[model samples]
Target: AQRVTQPEKLLSVFKGAPVELKCNYSYSGSPELFWYVQYSRQRLQLLLRHISRESIKGFTADLNKGETSFHLKKPFAQEEDSAMYYCALINGNEKLTFGTGTRLTIIP
Candidate 1:
């Protein structure tokens, strides 16, 4: 099973509020999970990876092997953080499977 799921299509958050974007995956082997963000008309770029254990643009994600989940989080939502986010899974040599994505809007 190689699949990535993002349940939310759109998320609205006020500035300075915490935000969370959920992601779930299913794979047979050790899979790599990634979060990609696309701002407006810009191309999609890698936001963070489960293996990196780092944060990008104030966003962080922790991979929970026990629950098989990788949920992106930010302590304070900013206007720039508002974008289309996609959860992806890479299983072995198989192609990357991406979720439909979630559009986040930060209301000032």
Candidate 2:
């Protein structure tokens, strides 16, 4: 079974500080990893994908196959960056398994 777990439900930090959102997954076969984000009232959008190796909105994530993790990271958090983040895994069937999600609040 493929599953994603986001240990933290909420992560609060001040603006301009580093932030790391933890994510762990379990899967038997090769999986595609992704990070999705939803701002206050906006639709969920793709933040980054392991295959793309691209960073979006100052955020980046690396797939750690050995540790079964894909943690999201940002060097400088911005107030506007505060939003809900979900870690997801695409299984062989192309079904995305999402974590409960973490609400990140960046204090100004």
Best by lDDT: 2
Model 2 residue 62 lDDT? Answer: 90
Evaluated with TM-score, which candidate comes out highest?
2
The per-model lDDT (C-alpha) reads 0.93, 0.94
> Residue by residue across 35-93, what tens digits does model 2's lDDT show?
99999989999889999999899899999999999999999999998999999999878
TM-score between candidate 1 and the true structure: 0.96
Which regions of candidate 1 fall more than 4 Å away from where they truly are? none
In terms of lDDT, model 1 sits at 0.93
Compute the lDDT of residue 14 as modeled in candidate 1: 100
RMSD of each: 0.8, 0.6
**How many residue pairs clash in each candidate at the backbone level?**
0, 0
